[model samples]
Target: MSQKDSNILDLLKGNLVKGDKDFELTDEECIGFYFSAMWCPPCRGFTPKLVSFYNKVKCQGEKFEIIFMSGDFDEETFHEYYAEMPWAALKFDLSSIKDTISEKFNIIGIPNLVIVDKAGNLITTNGRGAVLKQFGETVSLTWT
Candidate 1:
């Protein structure tokens, strides 16, 4: 892997939380980095749809994962927002790492979803549109 890929792996391997417990990504082939915030109106509208999509894909046994990258202003709001998500998140304390990830992905707006593969290859930066269009299985098949 290139140095940038190595850095991405290292950043992802750090602390992650799912619900109230610690969690880790294993053999998932497709990973979605969801850039969102609790305070953003668009993010608020999209989060539930993403949650439903996440559950649907997982129920169908898709080898996909999502990491919630919060743009929330504080820990309390972050946790409040994260609690509603079923997928894993970069730990609330790792705000700097979250910022680095946002910069790496060139996330310019709320409610963006950047899809990547296991080897840190870009799948699609317009993941939000894919999800919005409900291209769950069809799009997921391309990731692997």
Candidate 2:
């Protein structure tokens, strides 16, 4: 199991995805989540940057993903707005993590990005840097 998966397992008590109760995260993928809002100007600006960064990471064969946490509107609206982001998003059971995601991740605003290790522990708040610095020997090793 990847280190990130192990960390998230503790929080996987209920379905993280909607309509898929049997779904379980694998141990290999590093998860990224973006806390955003439809009306939040910062979120709108950062979404493109975040999406650009995410695509680069994926293209480099990095085992990482994102779960966009919508701070406004319902799941449908969230999906409609971010229909092209190259990562998975939270579906049902949003209330389960609304406060927890805010407090646990110390997220007081939108466009916040949190990077977790394979075990789901905090790796970097600078996920954009991780992808940018992937050419370095140490960083490449850490993610690979």
Candidate 3:
């Protein structure tokens, strides 16, 4: 496997998760990340919309979920402020690989969405559209 592929092998293998540190993606659970912050206006603007979408999917019994990565803040504030989020979020404590995500994904600003499947493969290059499309698709499939 290439270096990148090898690095992501675990995420691909369903190792990354929320709530339960031991819980993995199990052929279900659509994992996504909102690369934003509580400080940025656009990030704030998009948050509620994202939350609404999440609530809808959750209500419909979809197996997908999202997380928040505070691209530019400490973990304490991240958790304290966004405690009401419908989805799981990365712990605010770890900041080591923060840039790794930005560099690899080329995230330039706030409100960027990064989504990976159960196997850690990205769903689309277009983050915004992929988030909407995938979450919507999951909801639709689950409800009907």
Highest TM-score among the candidates is held by which one?
1
Per-residue accuracy of model 2 over 1-144 as CA lDDT, tens digit each: 632333444555444553333344565467776777777887786777667766665677877767767776666666566675666656544555555655677777666777776676786666544544553232341432
Candidate 3 accuracy as lDDT: 0.59
Per-model TM values vs. the true structure = 0.88, 0.70, 0.70
Candidate 1 Cα deviation (angstroms), residue 74: 0.9
CA-only RMSD, every prediction: 2.9, 5.9, 4.7
- Which order, best to worst by lDDT? 1, 2, 3
Compared with the true structure, what per-residue lDDT tens digits does model 1 show for residues 22-103? 8878999888999999999999999998888888889879988899998898999998999899999998788777787787
Score candidate 2 by TM-score against the native.
0.70
Per-model tally of clashing residue pairs: 0, 8, 2
Runs of candidate 2 with Cα error greater than 4 angstroms are 1-9, 12-24, 27-29, 128-144
- CA lDDT scores, all candidates in order: 0.83, 0.61, 0.59
After superposition, candidate 1 runs with Cα above 4 Å error: 1-5, 135-144
**Candidate 3 accuracy as TM-score:** 0.70
lDDT of 3 by residue, 27-129 (tens): 4555666777777887776777677777776787777767666765666667655665666655555444445555667777778877666666676435555
